[model samples]
Target chain A: MDYKQLQGRLRSNILKMHHGAGSGHIGCSLSCIDIMAAILKFKNEADTFILSKGHAATALYTILNETGAIPDEDLGTFYKNATTLPAHPAPLKYAAIPFATGSLGHGLPLATGIAKANKLKGNDKISFVLMSDGETNEGTSWEAAHFAVANKLDNLIAFVDCNGLQGFGNTADILGNTASPKLWEAMGFEVVECDGHDIEALMQAWKKLAANKNGKPKMVVASTVKGKGIKEMEDKMEWHYLPMTDAQYTAAKQEIRAGYGLEND
Target chain B: MRKHFSEYIERNLADREDFVFITGDLGYNALEGVAKKMGPRFINAGVAEQNMIGVAAGMASQGFQVLCYSIAPFVVYRCLEQMRNDVCFHNLPVYIAGNGGGYGYGIMGSSHHAIEDIATLSGLPNMQCYIPGFVEDMRATMDEMFARRRPAYLRLGLGKNLPADMQLVTGGTQTVLTPEARLTILSQGPVTNNLIAALAKSDKQNSIDVFTLNTMPFVTLPAALATSIATTKNILVIEEHISIGGLGSSLALLVNEAGLPLDKFISLHAEGYPNGLYGSQAYHQQVSGLGEENILRVINSYF
Candidate 1:
């Protein structure tokens, strides 16, 4: 599959969902679209992925819609009461989702447990959890990190969308002095750094981690720009909660098409 | 009883593939043997209650019967959100077993006390709360809870003063000491022993009925309990927990709602947190007004 084209389509679908609902985490969703696309390529009948940075549910829903894991009809009811995809990844709404995670700091522990269970049961399928950089601030996240290391969960892989901006402000200002990659390294994880928007680099990182026999949980710090596809909204914190007006939606659509060279394809 | 409970799980370890015992570094004297016996199935989660709960929930989600155990306060208080969200919300068969109910860890001070756990856990959806009054009762419940295999919370006491031949009740209240008495004393765990001792001292042991309630979140009074209430309009509920939302409060509501003729309803329970009082379990019980003398006084007042 052409992953770059898939990323563009997911970004477009996410924009449409946010515009249709009139409310959603557009910036966070856009930042993790490429990472989600890359990880979806690894998902098979047994492997599972948990979106710990659940504010980016739109991006995951869009990917699931594209990959045929979820019915395309469910995409139209995003963030509406008419469908179970109500702003966060609720597994009850879609059984294809392995577990529900909207509250921050819960996803890593749940993923660690699942990975540990699979290891105990001798299942070879890998379990992946994608989280936000700002989510590392929660104490439970650190507890789960320590737990994953102590248990030696070699089957577990975590990806952090390092978008630099959170709901409050830049992550650098809110979380003082501790870089997420270094922190994971200090906690005894085999850390990998990659360009968040580079699908090829992400695939390579995943492959390298899966091949390593070092018996440590792996964390990939995918450095990304929030609102990657839009010119005016990129890296802007206000866009985290901002809904697009009709004019802004039209302009975003035009910009995405022009940027991806799909305007006259 | 803690040792016995662990031994029960240990004895059945080889037979059951679905059972997994996890602790947050608790069960110092009770669980070491079970841990050694169960091998990979026994997890010591290392003082991380929140993570341990999530881990239990995750394992249960995959069809494993998980028991997340620790001291009373740490097991329920620190990780309640995970229990409510991850375990109860999914309705998974996760058994949250807290080792010290009420003042079980008394001299360890307020941080260790779990005087209000019943209220906290009972309010959650799909949670079955069990406070076992004797070692026999705890043994029976351990089997039944795992047999049914649903979401549950087991509040264990300090394992003292167990009656050898008392017939235990599983799903509702059981009148243990007195059968055909008019004034009934409703109590829980080892606190019932204290009430029995107090009543024995007053020579009213046979005249006064003592009933124990170990099953909750199935708070409906069974026919036997209702029948016990029918013979007696005067009821005194004594629990080691605080009165608010404890057995006392719940029984009051149950008795009143059941429309049993009631001349007097009294609950003898700990008032609230035992603030700044550091002493033995008995001393803490005394400070909370759960002492035998105080309970006898309350029961007398009700009559």
Candidate 2:
């Protein structure tokens, strides 16, 4: 698959969604779009995915649209009043979304529980959860990590969008290196590190974790830059909460299309 | 109450494979039988209330009936957002059993108290609150919660069996003791025991009617209870919870909406740690005017 083209298209749609809604979290959404795109390829009919870092709902919505799981009309309603695609994912609003989560640290525990239920029911279905590095600050995330390991949920795969920048500041400065491989390793996860923006690298990391039959939950410490596709927003904390103006949206779309040599389209 | 819960689960486990019980490292001596019967289904979520609630929501989403067990404050307060978003927002059948409701955890300090739990839990959409007044009510409450199969909270406290002579009105409002009287006493949880004891000794007991509520966020006032409140005109609501959002507040709203006449309305609830002291459950109850004597005094004053 042309992941670069896919990332370009996903980022463009995400920008359009944010621009249309006058919403924020564009940077965090961009940071994790590639990771989400790659993970969706491995998700089977029986598998479930949870966006623990719910601020990135637009990214998930865009990707779901790309995969034909979400209709284009629904994508157009993003962040509007009573829209199915809200700023945060609403539970059962979309078939793919399993929980209504905007609160950080909730997704992993929820995913772990789903994985545990699958295990108890004697199924091989996997549960995937994507979380922001900043969300690790919540004690519930670590508690879930311990529970996942103690239960030996080998079918669970967790991805941390290590964009480093959070709402207030860099996660490194706030939590002092939340994406350290050793931290997840200490919690009994089979940790895999990857360049989060590189689709091929993300795919490889996911493959490695999914292939592991060891009785431990999997973690992908995806190193990424916040606001990855747009030059002006890249690695900037302000982009986490700033909706793109018309000029910025046009420029961002042009930049992504130009990067993929599809400017004319 | 905990023992009754354990026994109920143990009895139902053989038939319901969907029943999953998770404790926040609580139920030390009360849940052994359940853990033994459930095996892997019984999860000791290890003192992580937030994670426990989220986990319960997750499991419930997959067609499982999940029960999350812990002290009232630990299960209700610490994971309020989790309950709101993960469980209640989705309307999942995740039963949260909170032991030590209100001052039931007295002497353990204010941290262990659940004074505002009813208000918080009942306020959530698609959520129901059940506070069993007697040990026998456990099975019925659990059955109702499971039968409804939605987000519900079971507030557990000291269990008191209804006296043989006392009749239960049944339905939404369980009228434990209803004497022909001009004043009606509405109460909730085991604190109703104090009212029952107080009524037994009061010479004016024959002049008052006592009703206990097991379910909260009432969809509507039961016709029978509403009639009693409307006719009596003198209403007193007693609860182990704080003043706001408890049975008192709920009853007041229901009565006002129904246009029931209230010549006088009084609510006695948890006053909290005004003296900044912790002691036994009885001591806390006494301080909050939830004691047997205080209940008798309040009932007599209405006469």
Best by TM-score: 2
Which ranges of candidate 2 are over 4 A from the true structure? B170-180
Q: Write the per-residue lDDT of candidate 1 for residues B128-222, one digit (tens) a residue.
A: 88888777777777778888787899988766545543466655335464455668777877677777667756755555666787877547876
Model 2 TM-score on chain A: 0.97
Candidate 1 ranges with C-alpha deviation above 4 Å: A177-179, A263-265, B160-166, B176-180, B203-207, B273-275
Instruction: Assess every candidate by TM-score.
Output: 0.94, 0.97
C-alpha displacement of B67 in model 2, angstroms?
0.7
Quote the positional error of residue B166 for candidate 1 in Å: 4.3
Predictions in order: lDDT: 0.81, 0.86
Each model's DockQ score: 0.62, 0.85
Fnat score for model 1: 0.50
RMSD of 2: 1.7
